[model samples]
Target: MKYILFIIITLTAIFSFSQDKEKEALLAAKKANNYVYEGNNLINEDDFVSAEKEYRKAISEQGTTVAGIYNLGNSYIKKGSYEEALYRLDQAAKIATSKVEKHKAYHNIGNVLMENKKCKEAVEAYKNALRNDPSDEETRYNLGLAKICAEQQKDKEDDKKDDKDKDKKDDKKDQEKKEGDDKKDQDQKDKGDQDKKEGDDKKDDKGKPKDEKNDKGKGDEKEKQQPPQPRPGQMSPQQVKSLLEAMNNQEQKVQEKVNAEKQKGYKIKTEKDW
Candidate 1:
């Protein structure tokens, strides 16, 4: 039984060796030198189409390297494939094990975005590059340019909003003014109507019966039309009191004279009956 197990082990080892040998042979045939040769041939012949495809295949098959990815991206750019180049380069950017590698990746991304007319994205890329490597004056300048563009856009928007608000405020003020004017007009109209009513009342007063108005109208007519009667002041209280006393004395005198006349006229007669 041990001999059988040994035989199985020997077979397994041989199989593994054969597989490794075949892989080595395949790698040797499609060597790194061959990819370089292919890339050089395409460059010489100006076969960017075929060259780009070959470069991309080479990059995929090889281990991740900035040179390979960057070369591939360049190939895509030559073929007018901006999006493809951007995608590959974006991958290269993340493979930064060192700070310098990270800065290079971010810096290149800024250039790519700039080419695509995406200044805002370029600004962000350049800012990231500067963060990784702040000594880069080019990145700082590019970031400043992007900021200017962004600020101009913001200023334009602010101006538009300000104009809109001004228009709204003016409209509101105009409406208020109109309302005030209308109120004033209505007040004037009401005053005019009151004056008109007063004028009509004056006309009515003019149309009243003259006789009834005469008492208030003419003092001379009242005096002439009425009999000459004693006024309150003409017959004063003291004068009235003296006249009444004189009238009382006259009445007593009249009674005494009447009684004397009656006594003088008396006639004596003998009569049994009364």
Candidate 2:
């Protein structure tokens, strides 16, 4: 049983060693130098699309080297594919063999981040680039610019928020003002209707139609003709004058009698038997 266990362990070790050897051979077989040279030539001629293909081929052949990934990332940047460029450049930074290569990776990463409007992240990337290669004045300048851009971006966002809040408040006030104006208009209309109704009731009590007031006024001159008097023998003016004189004398006698009774402290009340 012990011999079997030993054999199993030895076989496992042999298998692991063989796998490592195979992996090393595969890595060694990848020759990306020629493809990278060809890609560079294409890029110099401004043939970025073809250069991207060449760089991709080189990356596939070289199994992720700094040169292949950085070139591919540069090509992607020319194509305006900032997201892909950022990914490739980040990979280049992780696997870079030297400080110069790492600096280039970080510098390109900052460029991609800036294009994507990630100013704060870009500032950090440029700072990293400067750290990797302190002699790179361009990276230092970009870091300064990124800092400025981050501040400007924050200011712009704050301005937008302020403007948005102001607009919201203005809209609310306008709505409230509109509601108040509508209510005022409605109240005025109701009062006008009530006044019109009252005027109509007054007209009805006076027994006049709305259109008859001017019509009745137009007939006033025609109504001014005197009524016809009776003919002679029906009544005489002298007889009417005599009857009036007799009635006056009777009224004077009755009034004198009433005044004499009132002087004797009497409450003289006149009663009507209708």
Candidate 3:
């Protein structure tokens, strides 16, 4: 009988402990819900700072409170803190226990991505939202807009690439043309210098052309073979002839005197002959 009483006492202690734990859990859940309700009222009043505090309190009271996380994310969106909003919304979506909760979180995540100009990611996010709640017309509409934005962004990038390519091609052509012009100018300058050097080689000391000087020498030889022409400072051919005749007469007189001296020397020879 004492053993049975001991067993009953042990069972009662265990049940009491279990019941106490259940009551504590219920109390915490009630506190968490109260904080979430207070945060909602603050959000409606446009008091985001106070609402954020209340939401944080709800999350601290009950770590599994989806409403606390989701509302906190929405508050971040209102504050334009998109990165924070995305983080909280993503957490809420992962921990969501229902499709309705998941749809709300994904839809807001799409909104944040769209605000940040992430159209491609936003389109995927909206698509996920629709997967959870196919009846949501708003998510479908946002998905369409995101698709259009993504295409426009892609086309803009393509146009920029094309413009860059065209600019590069034009630059290359300009550089080639500049190089060709430089080469042509150098060639013309070199040719001009070569022609000048050849011209200098064909000249004489007197600055006269060598070919003209040679032709002048040939003309001088031809003049020597032709009859002489009289000039103002020179004797004529007729005067030269007169001067030669005078010289001949003087020589003949001298020869006659020499013969007279020979006849005088011959008198002695005639007497010897008699």
Candidate 4:
């Protein structure tokens, strides 16, 4: 029974070793390492496209190692691929087993967010990184920068709102001014029309002559403005007395002439009344 037990134990150990070998073969650690090395060298040379390709290859082979994914995220950042960088950095943070790795991942995530002009999210990311590694001066500095950026963005939005409101007020004033000008023109036109109507009512038409009675009424108005004239059968008392005195003077002159003729003759003739 002891011999049989020893043989069974030896077979179990051989089966375990085979399974380990197969798993190692499937993982291809050496291949993954080569890709990662090539990717790092490409990054150093600033060949971002090539570097990204190598990093992706490494990730496919190694199945998301912290170093591989983090480097890939950095490559994306250098390429200005913010969304991709954010995704990779977030994945790196989730898979990280140590505080150092977590700090680096969150720091890179903050950088990506900052690049995208998402200052608020960047601030939170930097804060998380600081929580993981409090001694990181870079993260603290970045947090301060993010806060300043956030304030500047808010001020910009407020300025835009003020400008919009000012534009609205200007438009309203222009509308009111236009309405006022239109009303003024309309009033002038109405006044002109009213004057025209009055003129029409005062004048004669081609087919209808002016009324004689109206002419007489106008003459009466003129008479009221002047002195009264004498009528054919009527005269002032001063004028009548002047005319009677003139007639009496003329009769006296005639009588004197007649007596002078009679005196020169020295004879008189009388005729019988018939």
- Compare candidates 1 and 4 on lDDT and give the better one: 4
Off by over 4 Å in 2: 1-29, 95-100, 200-274
- Which of the two, 1 or 3, has more lDDT? 3
Which candidate number has the best TM-score? 3
TM per model?
A: 0.44, 0.61, 0.64, 0.62
lDDT of 4 by residue, 1-274 (tens): 9999999999999999999998886677667778888999999999999998898888888885678899999998888888888999999999999999999999989888988899988999999999899999999999999999988998999999999999999999999999999999999999999998877776687645458798899999998998777788898677989999999999989778778879898644445578
Q: lDDT per model, in order?
A: 0.77, 0.87, 0.94, 0.89
lDDT of 2 by residue, 1-274 (tens): 9999999999999999999988975764455766788899999999998888878787777776678889988988988988899989999999988899999999999988998889999999998998889999999998988999999999999999999999999999999999999999999999999998887875755667566666677676456565446587666677789999999999999899999999999987788678
Per-residue C-alpha lDDT of model 1 across residues 1-274, encoded as one tens digit per residue: 9999999999999999999988976784466446656875896787987776666666666655555566667677667677987887778777757778778777777777777867778788888899899998988888888777767767888999999999999999999999999999999999999998776665545664346366566877877898676686698667789999999999999778778777999644435675
**Model 3, C-alpha of 41: deviation from truth (Å):** 1.0
Which residue pairs in candidate 2 collide?
none
Judge candidate 2 at residue 274 and give its lDDT: 80
Lowest-scoring 10 consecutive residues by lDDT in candidate 4? 265-274
RMSD of each: 13.0, 11.8, 15.6, 14.1
The list of candidate 4 runs beyond 4 A from truth reads 1-30, 94-98, 207-274
Lowest summed lDDT across 10 adjacent residues in model 1 is found at: 203-212
Sorting all predicted structures by lDDT, with the top scorer first, yields 3, 4, 2, 1
Give lDDT: candidate 4, residue 133.
100
Residue pairs in candidate 1 whose N, alpha carbon or C atoms collide under 3 angstroms: none
Q: By summed lDDT, which 10 consecutive residues of candidate 2 come out lowest? A: 221-230
